[model samples]
Target: MDPRFLGIPELTTEAPSVAVVVDVMRACTVAAWAFARGAERIVLTGTLDEALALKARHPDWAALKDGPPAPGFDLVNSPGQLRSADLGGRTVVQKTTAGTVGALAVRDASLVLCAGFVVAEATARVLRERAPDEVTYVVTGEDGRADEDLACAQYIAGRAAGGSPDPAGYLRRAAASRAAAELTQGVRRGSHPDDVALCLELDRFPFAMVAAEEDALLVLRRYDGNP
Candidate 1:
């Protein structure tokens, strides 16, 4: 069967066997870059305070939030910042505005994965390999009105359905989105200029980011296994 697309995460019920959350503007892109940089694992939190508290307790883990780095956090949730950090074997605590919240809201799904243009192809491959009876694509940005996330979700959903969708076309739509404009504004303010470009790097990672509950906390990690 074809994949189901969701807008408001809070109202989602009876989620399919697999749920793929997309936040192409930044959150999922950040995850892809962090894993690419060799971060051990990412602990996703809904609030900045929760992430900061976790960082305080761990002391060794890297803390990141949506905008600029907070007092207790190490960096912002930007791919450019993650690319420079030596995240090798370090745990990352992350709090974002939409991505992590949408992810954690998904219930009754056997597998929950995060996706952006960076890992879109890899995520589709994983879905095709697993071949779940049902799949749900959660566009976790601006109640699914965010063009970047919606475009990325459409691309992945098409690929998972055995179609060769033109990623360049999707990229164009994503670039014209409000989220992209926000990133551009962020760059002008010296908030990681490279992030705007980095988030659009299609198929940059070959691994998928999977989220699961561990020790009562939502944890994200790379899943590079065959079905």
Candidate 2:
């Protein structure tokens, strides 16, 4: 059957045959890197305090916390930082404004896969192979509302189920936004432009990491790589 889309609230009762959680702004991208770098697991939490608590309790596990700036934490939801860190044989606990929360919201799915624009093709290929009875794409939004998440959902939904995505249009808009931002005026002018460029590379990592509650973290690795 074709894959379907559902918001987080809709996930309360209806258990998805397979659910893919997306936070394209950064979280899922970082998770992908963590998996690539040999991270055993990643615990995704909604609050920084919860992540910190997890870290304190499990000192053996390498904990990395991320969220909005106002309420600070160990990290600031940047994929660059995650890539730079050596996560070999470590378990990262992530807290983000939207991504990790979205993962937690889809607590009822039989199988959950983390996704983002970076791994969109990989995600669709996995869905096609699994061909689950039903598929739900959950887009975790900032401030508990949909915008980029929904746009990304629409893009993936079209691809996974045999439709079309306006890739050019989307790229144009994204480029326009970046062009509009006068970064030179900012305090940190030359900060990590390569990082943003790296995040835009589609399907750089040939994997889809799934969250495992047995260890309360994502099990890193590839999903089959067959598209």
Candidate 3:
């Protein structure tokens, strides 16, 4: 069957056999890098309080939390933060408004894979291999309506179904809007610009992360084979 697309806000009800969580503006991308750098487990939460509570409980493990500046978390949902410190043996707990919440909503999925532009190819490979009865691409957004997330979702769905999507078109539109937002808001955002570049970087990583509910953490590695 062809893959299906769903906005992150719709995930709570329209569950699919396999759900791909897209947080292109950097939560999922950063998580992918955390695994690459040898992070043991990543706890994804929707709120700062939840992440901080987890961190307070697990003091031995290193924790990193990110969200909008107003909420005042440890990180700011930028992939740049992932490179700041070595997380060689730590467990990173992440909290974001859209990404983490979107992920948690589909906890019952047979297969749950985190996705972003950076790991699009890896995500597609995993979907092709699993060949689930149905595939749902969930795009997490800031206000249930972010252009970049929708563009990335469409790109992934198009690619997995043997169809072509205009990656440049989506990137151009998203990039221009983000650049404009930066100038007007003076927010000096890091995730969107870098994320737009990162998402377009195809197959830079060989593996994808799969969430294991029993373990409450992502199981990092490559999909075994193509379906």
Candidate 4:
């Protein structure tokens, strides 16, 4: 299958057989890890209020919104933030800067998969098994263009197409990009250099995260095989 990596806020009804949303720094990264570690299901919200409202209705679920740590959330949208949380049996309600928004925006996709380097190989396997005629990888940059997201898109698309994609080389490019500069320079709102480092780890997991809507809530589940 030929995979096309393109920017967000733009996907077509004639898009592709599958749409893989990439946000390496680090909304999708956090989502993949959250599911891998045994969170019941993650509900992706488009805003903080929506996430909070869901949490209010389902008090047992964990919430991760766009801003700072809220009143009753087990975690936030940072991969580093999720590392120490005990989310063994909880549900996570997440609203991020880009990844979740991109997931919801692409109504044209036959299948939507949330992606990062953590699940690139498995994602490729899933896409390969399905063998879609065309696959579109949406580089869901944080509010705008993000170097990390674009790099991950390249890595995942290259791997899915049976090529040796250099994630390390892409990582170098991301590190030198404007987004990284903002994070390191405190020009960006919700990130630090640690966040930059967290998202750069390539292909960190063995499974792909397939996004499916269950009961109107977009949930990302771990799929070790074909979607």
Candidate 5:
């Protein structure tokens, strides 16, 4: 089946068998990096408060958020930060402005996955392997105006359809996006230039980030084709 790209707000308009939430500017990229750093799973939350509260309850899990780390949180939601941190297989509780909200809003998808350029090809592979009749790519930036997320979604969609999508073409569009510029504005809005560079790397990870329900909480874990 062909893949459908939808803005985060339009998720409720249709029920998708598989929902791939794209947040290329940072959130999903951070998730991908966290896994690479040995984090066990990420608990997706809609609000920073929820992530903080969960962290407080566990006291062992890391709390990651967009912008600077909150008082009790472990680190900022940047792939650069996760790159240096050793999670020791601990769970991460994550909250972001767009990615987490869009991911949590998906109500009826049988499978919900997180995607960014870093995990683009792996995500497409998951979609192809699952062979779901309905696949929706949720652009989780600026209600879909964010070019980085849109381009990544298009690339993944094309690949999931068994085509060899042009990564250079998609990279050009994503790098030129306003979202990409903002992340490189030198600590503006708690974003860093390193993050922009890191998030734009294509297929940096070889696994998809799958968000699954565990004990009534949405948890994201590395998925490498196994159900």
Candidate 6:
């Protein structure tokens, strides 16, 4: 069970048996948390217009952007705030800088899973059960390659292969990564201290977020990784 890890979503070439879309900075992480909190389903979009359009069509679904809270959106792209959100039986429409877009782009993957440190172990557990011959960890970056996303891919793949990489070390490296610096400079939600830590909290969630296509849109659902 060898798994390939690629940095930058645009560079993904193969349609692996399984594609793990990793966005450690915030997007995928918060989605996992949302599902665990009882959100019915989440629609992920790469473009803000698509997200807005989806929300418009489905007024019941909450809408949010990738960064800070803005007008007409139900939430911001902050894990810190999502941890306390009332997501019970509700659906959310989200547009992130990368994760959702990457998941949608990889149409060849038989199984598309969104993951972060919070669900890393559980995701590994689920992947091991599926045991696809080819797996690609697609790390989404805001602009180019992001160290934090790369670290997340390494951790997820390592855990799935029964190898334990240094979690503390990975966190340390990510904290000082170019992605972190850029987020801070850009004043994005990833810049918040709590938001960063929330994304880095390894294995905090017991379920992996799986994407299923419905009406040509990917909606996320929680899959219990443990028996």
**Each model's number of backbone clashes?**
0, 2, 2, 0, 0, 0
Q: Across residues 65-162, which tens digit of lDDT does each residue of candidate 6 receive?
A: 87666766888777787888888999999887788777777755788888888888888888888877777888777543677888877887888888
Angstrom error of the Cα, residue 166, model 6: value is: 2.8
lDDT of 5 at 162: 90
Per-model TM-score versus the true fold = 0.94, 0.77, 0.81, 0.90, 0.95, 0.90
Model 5 vs truth, CA RMSD: 1.4
lDDT by residue for model 2 over 75-184, one digit each (tens)? Answer: 44556656676777877777765677777776556777888667777777777777776777786654324444555566666677766676655544333333213221
Clashing pairs in 3: 117-199, 118-199
Q: Model 4, residue 24: displacement in angstroms? A: 0.6
In Å, residue 210's CA in model 4 sits off its true spot by: 0.6
Q: Single out the weakest 10-residue window by summed lDDT for candidate 5.
A: 184-193
Displacement of residue 84 (Cα, Å) in model 3 is 3.4
After superposing candidate 1 on the true structure, give the runs of residues whose Cα lies further than 4 Å from its correct spot: 187-190
Q: What is the per-residue lDDT of model 4 for residues 72-137, given as tens digits with 9 covering 90 to 100?
A: 665766776677677888889888878888887763467888887777788888877787888888
Candidate whose lDDT is highest:
5
Q: How many Å off is the CA of 155 in candidate 3?
A: 1.5
lDDT of 3 by residue, 69-137 (tens): 443344555665565657777777777667777788787788888876667767777776666667877
Cα miss at 156, model 5 (Å)? Answer: 0.4
Count clashing residue pairs in model 1: 0
RMSD to the hidden true structure, all candidates: 1.8, 4.3, 3.6, 2.1, 1.4, 2.3
List where candidate 2 sits over 4 angstroms from the true fold.
Answer: 67-75, 143-147, 162-166, 173-195, 215-227
Model 4 CA lDDT for position 140: 84
Better of 2 and 4 by lDDT: 4
The collision pairs in model 4 are: none
The TM-score between candidate 5 and the true structure equals 0.95
Which pairs of residues clash in candidate 2, taking residues 3 or more apart in a chain or in different chains?
42-217, 42-218
Is 4 or 6 the stronger prediction by lDDT? 6
Instruction: Encode model 1's per-residue lDDT on 1-227: one tens digit a residue.
Output: 46777875444466567899999878899988898888989998988888878988999999888766458878788887778888899999988889988888874468999999999888999888988877888888989788899899999989887899888999999999988887887642325778778989999988899888889988999987642
TM-score order, best first, reads 5, 1, 6, 4, 3, 2
